[model samples]
Target: MAAAARLAWVDATSGVAGDMLLGALIDAGASLPAIRAAVESVIPAAVALSVDEVSRAGLRAARLRVEPLIESPPHRTWRSIRALIEDAELPEPVRDRALAVFGRLAQAEGRVHGVSADEVHFHEVGAWDSIADVVGVCAALHSLGISRLSASAVALGSGRVRTAHGEIPVPVPAVLELSAGWQVVSGGAGELATPTGLALVTALASECGALPPMSLESTGVGAGTRDTPGRPNVVRVVVGTPVAEGGRDELVLEANVDDLDPRLWPGVLAALLAEGASDAWLVPILMKKGRPAHTLCVLAPVERAAALREAMFRETSTIGVRETAVRKTALERTWVHVPLLGATVPVKVAHRDGEILQATPEFDDVAALARKLGMPVRTVLEAAVAAAVDQHLIPGAELP
Candidate 1:
C-alpha cells in the first residue's frame, strides 16, 4: 500500500509549473540528491538537476534547474517519453506518477490536435527539463511520503504567449483542455498554469477545494520565473498528517418530485452513489397544494456536483435541482480482517489522532456470512465485533 503520511495541498495562489513544483518539494525538505538520482536514471546523463534557494518578490523559495549539456530537440513522441519512464529505475509510485503526468499531456495534445495519444509529439514538454520537472516532482513527493494531494483553484492568465505552435492565447489550448471540469480564473495577463503544471496537478489531485484538516508538517514554496505585479510568482506545497478521517468540503444536492413513481427511489439513490456520491437518501415531504413527494438528496465532492446532477436528472423525474456547499468532517478510516463463523469478515475501523474510535463490521457482508453459515445477522455481526475486541483493534473503547 503506497500511501502518503497524510495530505499535500498545493496553493497555486500565483501559478504552477513543473520546475516550480519540484522546487517547492525541495524547499519543503525532500532530498535533492535522491530526486536527481531518480531523474537521472531515466533522462540523459548530460542533464544535470540542481535546486537553488532563490527569492522572488522578497519571498524565498527553491528553484529547480535542469541543465542539459548536450543539444537535443525540444520534442519527443509520447511513446518515447513513456518508454523512458518505464525503463527508469525509479520507485513504483514515482514511476506511476511520472507516467500519469506525461500521459495527461499526451491526452491533452491529442484532444487539441485530433490525434491519438501515442501519436502525439510533445512540443514544449519534449525538452529535457520538462522530463526532469515531471519525474523529479514525482520523486520528491514520493520521497516525502506525500501520497494524497489537493489544490486550491489555479490562477489563469490572459494575453498571448508563444508556444511551439506559434503565438497563441495564454491559458493555451492544452491547458484549457486539461482543466475542463476544474476551477480556473484569469488573474493576470500572462500564463499561470503551464501545460506541465496543469497536467501534474490534474493527474494527482483526488480533490480540489479547501485544505483538509491535517496536522501541519512542512511547507515548501517553488518559485516560478518572472514576477507578477500583484502577487509573488510561486507555488506552495503544504505537507501534513490528516487531522481526522474522511475530511474536506462536500456539496449537497436536492431535488423534490411529486409526480415520479415511488418504486424507482432505490435505483436512483444507487446511481448517485455509483457516480461518487458520499451518501444519498430520500426524505418524504409535502409539496405545494398538499402534494406528497420525496426529496432526493445526495452529498458529494464539489467536483462531482455536475455529475451527480446529471445522474439525478437522468435517473429521476425532476425539473430542477438545488445545490448547497457543505462542510463534512469525518474520521480517517482503515479496515482489519477478523475471523468470524469459521471465515473472515472485514471490520471497518475509524480513527482520530491515531486512536481507534469505532469498529464495525460491514452489515451487508455480515448478512451474507450469516446466510452462508445459517445464522442470524446479529450473530455474525457480534462475532465480528468480538474478533475485533480480541485483536485489540481499539483498546479502551467499548464494544457491543
Candidate 2:
C-alpha cells in the first residue's frame, strides 16, 4: 500500500500574502534555491529571491522578497499564464498547481468584471512578484511532497488598501469572489488578505478548520511585508502526517424527510458529499403518527457543517436540520490496489498494532468490476480478495 498523504495546513490567523506564504515555506525548511530555480524556469523575467530571518511583532519569521530585472512589465492574461506554465520546465504537479492558483485568481477577477476567466487580464497579479510568489509556493509544496492542503478560518484585516483599481475596501472583490463558501473573520485595520493569497488558499485548501488529526513535524512562520500592531503579520504553515486519533469530535447534521421523492436520494447524497460532508447516509424511520420517513444524516467537520446543511436544504426537501456534536473512533486503515480481471481493485485493510486484522475489497470497485466483467458483485469481490491474499497484502490474514 502507498503511504498515507502528508499535509500542510496554513494558519492564516493574521492574514496571508504571496510573499508571506513563500517565506513561511522557507521557514518550514523548503529549499530556497530550489524554489528560486523553479520560479525562474517558469517566468521570462530575471527573478531574484532573497530570504532573510526577520522578527515580526517579537516573533521570528522568514521574510521573502522578490526583485525582478525587467521594467515596465506587461499585463498578462489567463491564457498567457496558462501557456507559460504549460511550456515551463518545472515539475508537472508544480506547474499544474501554479496554474490552478492563477486560474482561481483570474476567475475571481472575471466574475467581478463580468468577463470569462480565460479572457480576464490580470492587472496587479500579472506582475513579477505575484508570479514568483505563486510559483515558489507551488514548487515548495511539491518539494515537501504535500499532497493535501488545509487551512483554518482566515482573518481579514479592516480598512482599505490600494489596488490597480485605486482605493478599494479591505477583503477586495477578488477575495470575496474566492471566499464564497469559506470561513473568514475580520481583525484590526488595513488590508490583511490580498487577492493572490486568497486565491491561492481557496483554490488549494481541500478543507478548512481547526488542526486535523496529525503528528507534528515542523512549523514555519512567513512574515508579511508590513507588520501589524499587536501580532506579527504572518501566515503559519503546519506540516505533518495524518494519524487516527483515539477520540475525535465531529458534527452530525440530520433532517427527516418524508415528503421528498426517493428518486432524488442519490443526488442529495452526492451534493452533501461535494459540499464537504465526511459521510452522508439515509436511514428509514417512522415519524409521528406512523408516518414513514427517511432521516438524512450528515457527519462533517464542524467548520463545514453550515455548508453541508445548505447543500442538504438545496438538494432535499428538508425545512429544518438538527445539529449534534458527536464523538467517534476509527481504526487505522490502508488501501491497496490488487489487479483483477484487467482492472485495479482497491482493497481496504484495517489494522491494529501493525498487524493485519481484516481485508475487504471496496464495494464501489467490486461493483465496477462486476459490470466490466459481466459477473456478480460478490464474485468480483471474492476474486479481488483472493488476489490480494495471493499478493500477500496482509500476511496471515483472512478476508472479512
Candidate 3:
C-alpha cells in the first residue's frame, strides 16, 4: 500500500501572492536552495530569489523577494511560457504543477481579454519576478512532499489599481474570472489578491474554507509588503499528516420543511450533492402545530457549506437553515475487483492499521451484473461475496 498523502492548508484571509505563498512554504521548512535551483533550471540567471524575516502587524514572518536581473524582460505569451516550462529540467511534479498554474492564468486572461489562451500575453505575470515566484512556489511544494492543498476564502481589495491595461477595479477581470466558484470578500482597500496568486490557489487547492483538521506538524507565515494596522498582512500555511483514526471536520446543515411537494425531495437532495454536499437526506419529523415534515440534512466540508446552504434555500421550502460543526470518523477504504458471472464486480474493503474490518460487494455493480447475466440480484450479490471470500477479502483477514 502507498503511504498516506500529506496535507497543506493555506490561510489566505489576509490575501495571497505567489511570492507570499512561496515565502510561507519556505518558512515551513521547504528548502529555499532547492526552490532556487528549480527556478534557475527554468530561467537561468533571469532573476534572484531572497528571503528575510519581516514583521507584519508585529507578527514575524518570512518575506520572499524576487528581483529581476534583466533590464527589459519581454512579455511572454502562454504558448512561450508553456514551452519554457516543458523544456526546463525540473522534477515532473513541479513541472506539472507550474504548468497547471500558468494554464489557469492563461485561460482567465484569455476569457477576460477576449483572446485565445495560447495567444494571450501575460504582461505582469510573464515578468521574470512573477515567473520566479510561480516556479519557486511549485518547487517548494514538491520539496515539502505536499500531496494535498487547500485554502480559505480569499481576501480581495475594494479600490482600483493600475495594471497593464491602466486602472481597473481591485479584483481585476482576470482575477474575477479565475475566482469563479470560490469564495471571496472585500478584505481591504487595495489589491490584496493578485491574478497570479488567485491562479495558484484555484489551480492547486482541492478545497477552500477554514483550516482543516490535521495532526499538528509545522506552521509558517509569509508576510506581504505592507503591515496593515489591525490585521496581519500575511499568508499562513499549516502542514501536517492527516489523522488516520480520528474524526475529520465537517458541517451539518439542516432545515425543516412541511409545505414542499414530497416528490421534489429527491431532486433537492440531488441538487445539494451536485453543489458539493457530501451527503443530503431527509428525516421524517413533526414540526410546530404537529405538521408532518421532513428534516433535510446536508453533510458538507466547511469550504462547501456556503454553497450547499444556498442550494438548500433555493431547492427546498424551508425558511431557515441550521448549521452545526461535526466530526466524522471513517474507515480507510480501498476496492478490489472480483469476477462475477464472467464480469468483474468491485468490492469495497474497509480497514484500519492494515487490519481488514469489512469487505462488501458494491450493490450497484452487483445489480448491473445481475441484469447483464439474466440472474437474480440476490444471486449476483451472493456470488460476488463468495468470490471476495475466496480471494481472502473478508473481515479479520489481513490487508496485504
Candidate 4:
C-alpha cells in the first residue's frame, strides 16, 4: 500500500527485449527464488528457472532461462493462457498480479489480431519461456516492493524480423500496435526490439519520455542475447529514492502582455509545450487601461524557468515575467491490481487515516482492457469499483 518505497526507471534507450528486460529486473535486485516460487505456483507442470551472469555489449547482467516440462507450442488464445496462469495453484497475490499482466497482453493480442479476448491467441506471449519472462518479471517487480515505474523512450531497432506469422517489416506490427499511445524510437543496428518488449512497456510504464532528474542510486543492466560491433546490447534498470517528492516540484511563471497581437497567443502556448512546460495558459483581464489583455501563465519546474521565460519574451511583447515558488499538496498515490468487468485493471488508490478514500482505474489500464474485451471503459471502471467495494477491500468497511 505504501508503494514498495522505491522508484524504478527502465533505460530502454537502446531498446528492450523480453529476456533482456527480465534480466535487467533481476539485476536490479528482483529475487530469483521468489520469482521461481511464484512461477512454480502459477504453472502446473514442473519447470526450472535458471539465472546466470552474462554480458551484452560489454555490460554485465543476469540471464534468465527456463526449462519447461512440455515442448513449446504455437499461438494460444487468451482464454487458454488465462487457464494456464490461473490453474498454476499460485498464491493469491501472485496469481492476481500475474493475471493482470496476462489480461493486458490478452487485450493487446485481441486488438492486434482482431479477435475476442477468448479467441485471440498469443504468438510470442503464449510461449512457455515468454510466460516465465512476463510472469517472473511481474513477480520480481512486486517483490521489489516498489511503488512507481518509469521508462525512457523505447529504442526499436530497424530491419525485418521472422515471426511464426512470417517475415514482417521493421518495428513489427504487434510492436507497433502495442506502442500505440507511447513514444518510441527506432534505428538500432540489429533486431534489438520485439513485440513482447513493447507490450510490457505499454502495460506498465507510467510515462514514456526522457529520464526525469532524480538522485542516482542502484543500477542494474539486463543483457540481451545479441552482440553488435558498436553500442552495447543491454537494458539498464535504475532504482532509487526520488530526490523530489513524487518527482514533481511546483513553480509559477507569469508575464503580462498588453501590447501583444491576439494572433500571437496560440503560437506562444505551443512554444511553451515544446519547451516542456508542465502547464501553460492565458487569463483574460483588464490591464491599466479599461482595455483588454491576457496574462500569460506558465506552471513548470524550476529547471525550465530560464527557457520558459525566454520563450515568453521572444513570443510576446512582455517586458518581463515574474517567477514565484508555490507549495502544492499532492496525493500519495499507488496502483493496485483489481479484477473488474471481466478484466483486470490497475486501480490507483489515494488514501489517508489508513482508511480507503479515493480509488480510480488508471485510464490507460481501463482503456487497454476495454479495447481488448470490446467493452466500454466506463463499464469496466464501474464494475471494478463495485467489485472493490464488495470485497471490503475498498479501505474502510467490512464485507456485508
Number of the top candidate by lDDT?
Answer: 3
Summarize candidate 4's per-residue lDDT along 155-176 as a digit string, tens digits: 8878887877888788876677
**Tens-digit per-residue lDDT, 84-110, candidate 2:** 887889986677678767866876788
lDDT of each: 0.81, 0.80, 0.85, 0.70
Give each model a TM-score. Answer: 0.65, 0.65, 0.65, 0.60
TM-score of 4: 0.60
**Taking the candidates one at a time, how many backbone clashes does each contain?**
5, 0, 0, 4
Off by over 4 Å in 3: 1-4, 244-400
Name the 10 consecutive residues with the lowest summed lDDT in model 3.
301-310
lDDT of 4 at 108: 60
- What's the distance in Å from true for residue 361, model 4? 26
Q: Tens-digit lDDT track for model 1 on 209-302?
A: 8877778889999988886555889999998877645546667788888988888888888888988899999999998999999999999775
lDDT of 3 by residue, 197-275 (tens): 9988876776678887778678999988888888899999999877653566677888888999999988998888887
User: What is the Å distance of residue 333 in model 3 from its true position?
Assistant: 10
Better of 3 and 4 by lDDT: 3
